[model samples]
Target: MYQYDEYDRALVFERVAQFRDQVERFQAGELSEEEFLPLRLQNGLYMQKHAYMLRVAIPYGTLGARQMRTLARIARDYDRGYGHFTTRQNIQFNWIELEQVPDILQHLAEVDMHAIQTSGNCVRNITTEAFAGVAADELIDPRPLAEILRQWSTINPEFLFLPRKFKIAICSAREDRAAIMMHDIGLYLYRDGYGQMCLRVMVGGGLGRTPILGQMIRQGLPWQHLLSYVEAILRVYNRHGRRDNKYKARIKILVKALGIEAFAREVEQEWQHIKDGPAQLTEDEFRRVAEGFEPPAYQGQGDDELEYGSHLTMDRAFARWASRNVHPHKVPGYASAILSTKPGPSAPPGDLTAEQMEAVADWSEQFGFGEIRIAHEQNLILPDVRKRDLHALWRLACEQDLGNANIGLLTDIIACPGGDFCALANAKSIPITHAIQQRFEDLDFIHDLGELSLNISGCINACGHHHIGNIGILGVDKNGSEWYQVTLGGSQGKNSALGKVIGPSFSAEEIPRVIEQIVATYCAYRELDEPFVQTVQRVGLEPFKERVYARAPEVEPCAI
Candidate 1:
């Protein structure tokens, strides 16, 4: 993980002091809510249903043991004993008191972390592949580029107040685990034919009221021009992006309105003037960032036979967890273990209790590298666990009910804290997710369903990425009643596609059955080992829709 330099520390602490003053003024009635909104938002504080919520950025979702321990401390001492990990790899404390935010920020700064750009109409957290450096299939480590972008975007005066909040994700692996297609700016780092590293820029991609897969604007762009090119895109959007209506403010909306060709032309025209400017990265700069991400010291056992295999054979439960939770590591005789946050009913998706956080911190060092990663799928990753230690790590994970073997399964749901926490949510998301999770708690049955994704957002904002889940669920408000809408055929990857609505929204009580029907339909039509998504595409939404709408009413559906 990249350690903060003096300049970085100064900036973060200085910002914290400034925010402390802002909060003081707002409390003293020196600043109105209107005047204080932007300031608080810039600091990643939001007014939720019960109290303030503080979102702390886990930049590109990388954290060391010290940082993780600090986060656990914050959760234990300040807010409730748990924090919610978001899809963006950020963590949110939902019960934050307005007065203690400064203290929280100070504590975060102490661990080289901050809440900057986690929210508001600016470049949010610069996310990348969670297993960037450790993925065996990676072309290059995307974390350095992600960190460079993070530094470039942080407090970049030109983009601080864009027309709308912008999100950027970088991916280097063949699999698009970062959901590159659903970001305001998606950069896929790859090597060209000549064997030089470059970026494939995709712009105008986002999900909300309007969902659009990013269009490829620039391909084979030299990695050195990353900052310059990003500046050009932001400049174009800032100058022409709509300001009149918040709904039409995202860069994706602007890109859609202007067509890819014209948009690319404008960005190119803008880039020509600034291509060699101060922002153009230098070889030394790349070296400096790359040094921080050098490969960890390995034991060099090279896929040797180990007790881990014996343990797997002896313990069915451990084997089950290992099969789904463990992923291949770049280094030999090592693995990347996913600690599932989705334990069903007991814990909400992407949530961790203070004790659990501390345990994970201990496990990160005890198992592999002294670092942890938060995947876009709302799971925590121990990036380089030695294969021999899988059983021990699994035992530690099982302590907090985090040993569920449901990664990428139907019960491994991606969900947002809807009406339960978010003020903007139309319905309660956690309860519904729990309801569905309880209905499908059978691990064997869930595995039988095979490689499924179900995402739920409290509103059309798509915070849960409901637009990209194999089965997307959105909470709707119909005459003050909580209704749930379902979308199918959505996925995130090379073949990313937005989900299509099946029918009218169903009530909370009816949603679990609706999902069951959809699953049954997929199981009936699937051939061989085809995944749920392939079956949906092959047979179209008609089969699922027919089974779903049989009980659905004629009411209009929520346009998620």
Candidate 2:
């Protein structure tokens, strides 16, 4: 984790004081509601249906144990006893009081964290893979570059007020765990033939009213020009992106309207002027940032495999948990273990109680380094756990209700804090999520179903990333009632694809059965050991659609 320098601390504290004054003014009738709206948004505060929600940025999803402890303290003392981890690798406190926001911001600043750029039209938190430096198959860690982008974009006068919120994600692994395809700007970092770091830039990816996978605009871009090149892309967007309609303001919309070729040309034309400017990253600058992410010192001597294998053979329960929750580590005799926040209906997906948060922090130090990571899937990861300590960690994790052995299974559903919290939500997402979790509670059945992704969003904003799930569910408003539209065959990764809608939206009551029917159809046609996504791809959505709609006459199949 990167420690904050004097400048970083000063900026955060200054912002905190500034926002505190603004909040006080608004409460005292010195500022109108409309006047306070942008001020609050710029500071990552949202007036939700019930209360204010504060979103705190966890840059690249990395956290120190001390920082985690502070977050736990805030959850325990301030709002509710828990916080919701979002798909963008951030956390939201849903029951925040308007007056206490300044205090919360102060606490975050003390921990070298803040809510800056977590909301609003400015560039948001920069994200990369959770297992960035430690992934066994990683080419290079993308965090150093991601951090560079974060610092440059934070409070940059040129981009503070873009047409719409901009999201940027970087991925360096063979697998695209960061869901780079769905971001406003996605960069893939890799080494070229001469072993020089290079980037492949993609643009126009977003999911809201319109979902489109990013198109690769530039490849073989030198790492030295990373900032300069990105500046060029954002410049093009800042100038040409639509401002008349919020619905059509995303960079994706502009890219679509102007076409990729023309957009690339625009970026290139802008880049020529700044390509060799001071913005170009130098080796010393790269090392200065990279030093923050150096790998933890390893004590194991690569001899724990036999003992770990023996434990796996001895305990079937532990074996099951290990199979699903454990990830390969680049270091020998070590592994990254995912603590599933999506345990069941008792806790909503992506939510962690304050007690659980503290426990995770303690476990991170006990089992590995005192570093924690938040996955885009909304799970906490102990990224350097020793393989030898697998059994012990499993026992402790299971006791804490964080040991659900369903990483990529059907029940590991990704969902937004829908109508329950968010005012923008069309329907209640948690209830639907709980219903589906209850319907498919059997671990054996879910494991047999194989790797599957099911994501739900309260609305088309796609906050839960419904567009990239293998099974996507979007809540829609029909007159005054809430209905859910389903999409199948969507997937994220190197072969990312936007899911296609199966048919018309279904009532809340019918969602569980609808999902069950889709799974049933998948099981019937699936080949030996075929994953649900591969099955959907091979057979298409027709069978699942036919199965879902065939028996229903009461449910009308029409556009919402």
Clashes per prediction? Answer: 0, 0
- What do the candidate models score in CA lDDT, each in turn? 0.91, 0.92
Tell me the tens digit of each residue's lDDT in model 2 across 1-560: 67777888999999999999999999999999999999999999998999999999999999999999999999998978999998989999999999999999999999999999888998999999899899999999999999999899999999999999999999999999998989999999999999999999999998989999999999999999999999999999999988999999999999999999999999999999999999999999999989988877888546689889999999998999999999999988999999999988999999998999999999999998899999999999999989989889999999999999999998999999998988999998999999999988888888877799999999989898899899999999999999999998899999999999988999999999898888878777788888888998899888888789975332321111
The stretch of ten residues in a row with the least summed lDDT in candidate 2 is: 551-560
RMSD of each: 3.3, 3.1
The reply for model 2, stretches above 4 Å from the true place, is 551-560
For model 1 the local lDDT of residue 15 reads 99
